[model samples]
Target chain A: MVTLEILAISMPISVLLGIALGTARVYGNVIIRGIASAIVITFRGFPVLVTLLLIFFGLSDFGIYVPPFWTAVIGFILCSGSYQSEYVRGAIRSIDIGQSLAARSIGMTKLQEVLYIILPQAVRRAFLGITNELIYLVQYSSLAFVVGVPEMFAVTKTFNSLYFRPVETFTTLAVVYLVMISVLVVFFRGIERRLAIPGIELTTK
Target chain B: MNSNIPVLKVENLKKSYSGRIILDGVNLEVDKGETKVILGPSGVGKSTLLRCINMLTLPDSGKIWLEGVELTNPNTDINKMRQKIGFVFQDFNLFHHLTVLKNVTIGLTKVKKIPEEEAIKIAASALEKVHIPNTLWNKYPAQISGGEKQRVAIARALAMKPSIMLYDEPTSALDPQLVGEVLQVIKELSTAGMTSLIVTHELHFALEVANELLFIYNGKIVEQGPPEEVFANPKHDMVKKYIASIYSRKG
Candidate 1:
């Protein structure tokens, strides 16, 4: 339940942030592009655990306090969003330049070109990378336990300590993670197929 | 909407890329309902001229008027101006992700702010004008043939109901067999009294559909007149040579 809650909070926020940052990096003017690039590089480079620690613990030192659960959510969003931006950027670049040009020649403004013509195609191209990121986010939810959020791993640890059954408990935990990841992989595969372009296939090897 | 004003006019248009001149003081005009074909050898700024008319490639120095609006003025709203002049590309640049119907309707609904039902009505008529069957309207660009893709592109532009249509080598990328269908559509548009400026290498199609033919060479309009007159007289040595090469190839 905690794992699902963390994912529910983090995934949508991260995806939206990633799209905004990615588009700014690709199409924004000098100042915006530079800022987006800096954000993406900084968050991608910093460790997620350290980032969570910084938000939850280090910020209190500077006279700001955020609750532990929200801190973990913020950390996951920042970290995942930066990585997601790179995938989105790659997908946007992979689209042919002619698509935007065609849209413009038909009298669509630049914003309309990106919104109607470019982003739909870019999202499809980014699908595989995005699904991979989602899986990573699911696993990374376990990191919330370190910040005192009683998520999946945290609950399982408490149960294991009380029961004193290391082998059985750990095996069950591994199986649960495997089941969760498998469901995610299968669900996204269906989406990828449904949204697949009729004549073109995008594959990541 | 003034009948006296030419649909499109270009004067002293000049453009260059990296110290290399492309269009050098080029000038032309297309009256309402006139079809003008621009014929030139490859790399002679034919496509660049079309791009400049639409301001897709801004001219280094030029004046362009579409329906008497000074498009060259910096204050002109380019996006709105583009709605008046529809442009078709050499590569049939259809939005690959969109259905044929959506490709045509997008501009009408989004840019023109027409209601979706009205846009669909206009789009359907435009597609029908290009002879695209109703069955193909739901298909993506990649699902269609090269010729059908070009027709879809034409339909896309036509649905905007522009005063003038600019075709930049509309058939250049097609297979030899596919070229005829695309050219046939353009020929029909010309006969239907649509004002058009076409850049093409197809000498036969130029002679057939063009009310006036402009032969560009070395970045200038070297010869231009009614197609029949230019073809028969061949005033310039360069034009004479060009006609000879095309005829020899035909033989």
Candidate 2:
């Protein structure tokens, strides 16, 4: 339940942030591009656990108090957003340059080009990577236990300590995660198939 | 500006990349309802010249006038100006995600801000002009033949009702069998009095459609005159050689 809540909160935030940052990196002017690059590099290079610790513990020393659950949410968003942005950026760049010129020749503004022409195609190309990111988010939700969020793994640990049935408790927890992740994989595969472009595979190969 | 002012005028246009000159001291004029065909060997700055007219590739230094508006001026509203000048690329740069009707209607609704119903009416008529059957209107570009794709591209441009159309090798990318269909649409557009500047390698089509033919060599207009005059009495040695080579290849 706790894992689901965090995933629900963080997934949308990460996706939106990823798109904005990715677009800025590609199309923004020098200053905005530099800033977006800095953010992506910082979050991607730092460990998610370190990011959580900084937000939850280190910031309290400076008179800033963020609750443990929100800290985990923020950390996941920051880390996943950076990775997702790279996926989106790669997808956007993969589109032919002629697409932009075609839009411009028709008098569509830069914003209109991105919104109507570029983004729809780019999102289609980036769909599989985005689905993989969601799965990673689900597994990484276990890290929330370090911040006292009592997510799935943390709850399992508490149950095992009290009942002293380590083998059975851990087995149930493993099965639960497997089932949840397997369901996610199946659902996203269906979406990929449904939205597939005819005569054109999404694979880079 | 007088009524006799050329619909499109380019003067002293120059461009270079990596210190290599692409177009140097090029000039052109297209009167309203005139069809001018630019003929040249490959890599002779023909494509660059067309791109400059629409500002798709900005010229290094030039004066471009469309309907007497100075397009090279920094303060000019380029987007609005571009709406009046339609361009068709050799590669048929259609939005793959959009169906043919949607592709034609996108500019009208998005940039021209025409209502959807009105835009559809306009787009349908434009597509009809290119002889793209109504059955193919809902199909994606990928589902169509290369020739159909080119016609759809032309329709997408024509839907804007541009004052002047620019075509960059409209037939070069097609299979030989498909070339005639695309060229036929262009010929119809010419007969219908659409002002167009075309870059093409089809010597026969150029002779048929061009009111004036321009032969460019090494970023310069080496010969330009009525197609019959230039073909029968070539003044430049380079133009003569180019003509000979094309005919010999066909022979």
Candidate 3:
């Protein structure tokens, strides 16, 4: 339930941040592009464990504090959002140049072209990449245990220690993770079909 | 609007890509309701001229005016100027994700900010003008034939209610059998005084519909006159040879 809580909250935030940064990197002016690039690089450069640790402890340097669960969630969002931005940027570049030309010829401003023509196609094409990111989020939620959040891995560790049956406990953990990923894959596949366009490709893979 | 001022005009238009000149000092003017057809061999800057007039391909240095308003002025609002000119591409360039009706209405709702119900009504009439039947309104671009796709592209541009239309080899991409249908639509539109500038290789259609025919070579209008006069006389060697080559291919 705690894993679901983190996933449900952080996934949407990460996806939203990814879209804004992706668009900024592609279409923004020089300063905005530089800022977006710096954000993506800084977050992606650090290991997720280090990020969580920094968020949990580093905020104390400024005389502010965050709980372990919230820190884990924030860290995951920053880390995952960087990768999501990369996928979104790649998808945006894949749309043909002619699409923008047509949009401009129809008197659409640069912003309107991106908003109406480019982003809709790009988001659809980014669906598979986003779904992959979501799958990773499922596994990364386990990292919350490292920050003392009583998520699935923390409970599993307690159960193993209490019963002294490492193999059974760990094997059950693996099965549960497999089921979680499989359910996500099926859910995304249904939505991808609904979003599919006749002549456009969402993803080749 | 002054009746004497041309609907579209270009002065000293020039452009080059990678130091290779595409348009060098091309100039022309089109009054309201005048149809001028430009004919040239491949890569002769004919399409570039149309694109420059539409400001799609920005000229390195040039001037364009629409109804006496200077479009090439640095301070002009380009999007607003573009709204007054309709451009149709060779590949039909319809929004592939949108259905045919949505394709026509998108510019209306999104760019013009017209309400949805009114945009649909405008789109319906525009589609009808291009001879697209009611049954195909919901079809996707990939689901339709090349002829139908071209007509839908025309309808998309026509829905803007532009003062003048620019066609860059609109029929060049269609199959031979499908070319006549698109040409017929262009002919009908021109005859009804749509005020168009067309870049095409279709000699018969050009001779039939054009009030004036221009032959461009190496980024200059080397030969131009009434369609009959230019075709009947041998003023420029390039024009004469170009007409002969096309005739040999057809004969």
Off by over 4 Å in 1: A203-205
Which runs in model 2 stand beyond 4 Å of their true positions? A203-205
The model with the greatest lDDT is: 2
Candidate 2 docking band: medium
Expressed as tens digits, the lDDT of each residue in B5-107 for candidate 3 is 9999999889999999998898888989999999989999998899899889889998999999998997999998898899999998888788999999999
Per-residue CA lDDT of candidate 3, range A64-156, in tens?
A: 889998998898889899889988999899988878888999899999999988998888888789879878988988999888999989999
Q: Write the per-residue lDDT of candidate 1 for residues A40-115, one digit (tens) a residue.
A: 9989998888888889889999999988789989999989989998889998998898898888898889999999
In the range B33-87, model 1's lDDT, one tens digit per residue, is: 9999998789999999999999888999989999999999999999999998889
Once superposed on the true structure, which residue ranges of model 3 sit more than 4 Å away at CA?
Answer: A199-205
Query: What number of clashing residue pairs does each candidate have, in the order they appear?
Result: 0, 0, 0
On a 0 to 1 DockQ scale, where is model 2? 0.76
lDDT of each: 0.91, 0.93, 0.91
Positional deviation of residue B16's Cα in model 1 after best superposition, in angstroms:
0.9
Q: 1 or 2, which is superior by DockQ? A: 1
Listing every candidate in turn, what is its Cα RMSD in Å to the true structure after a full C-alpha superposition? Answer: 1.4, 1.5, 1.5
